[model samples]
Target: MAHYRECPAYDVFAPNCPARLVLERLADKWVLLLIDRLSAGERVRFNQLRRDMAGVSQKVLSQTLKRLERDGLVERQVYPTVPPTVEYALTELGATLGGTVERLAQWAESNMPAILLARQLYDQCGE
Candidate 1:
C-alpha cells in the first residue's frame, strides 16, 4: 500500500495537488449554485435544479451533477416509473461541503452590496 508520505510530491497547497482538484470542482459556478440550492435538504429533480439555478442550461446542470456524483459529493437516485424518476441529494461528504458552501454563500450575499458599491465608486473615481 502506498502512503501519502511515501509520495515524492504531496504538497496540497501546490497548484497541481490532487486536493486542488476538489477545489477546482467546487469552484465551478454551476456546482456552487447547485450545491447552494440543494442546501435546503430538498431532494431536487433535474428540472427543479434547472429552475433553481437561474442561468444554468440543461447541458451544464447535467455535467455539473455528473461531476458532483463522480466526486462522491452528490447522490443520484433513480426510481422506476412511467417517466423514470431521478432525484439528487447530498451525500455525507456533500453535507460537510454544503455547510461550508452555505457559509461562503452567506458571506457573499451579505457582502455583495458593499462589493458592488465599492466597484461603483471605483468606476466613478476612474481608479
Candidate 2:
C-alpha cells in the first residue's frame, strides 16, 4: 500500500488510489442527489427520478445510476409489466451510506451561508 503511494505517478489521483475514485464519485452532485432520493424508502422509476431531481439530464441520471448500481449501493429491478417496468432502490449498503450522506446534506444546508461568507472574504483578499 505504501509502495503504491510512493510510485511517483504522474496523476496523483490514479486508479490505483481508491480515494481519488471515491472523491470523483462523491464530487458529482447528481450521485448524492440520487442517493438522497433513493433513501426515501420507495422504489423510484426512471421518470420519477427525473422529475424529483429537476435539471438532471436523462443521460447524466442514467450514468449516475449505473455507477451507483455498480458500486452495490443501489439495486435495479425490472418487472415483467406491460412496458417492462424498471425501478431503483437503495440496497443495504446504500441505506448505510444514505444515513451518512443525509447528515452531510444537513451540514451543508446549515452552513451554506457561512460557507458563502468565507468565499466572499477569500475573494475580497484577491487570492
Highest-TM-score candidate: 1
lDDT of 2: 0.88
lDDT of 1 by residue, 1-127 (tens): 3343443575767655576677889889789877878877878899988887888889989999999999998999999998999999988788877888888889999999999999999999995
Q: Least lDDT summed over 10 consecutive residues: which range in candidate 1? A: 1-10
Off by over 4 Å in 2: 1-15
Off by over 4 Å in 1: 1-10
Worst window of 10 by summed lDDT in candidate 2: 3-12
- Residue pairs clashing, model 2: none
Cα shift from native, residue 88, model 2 (Å): 0.2
Residue-pair clashes, model 2: 0
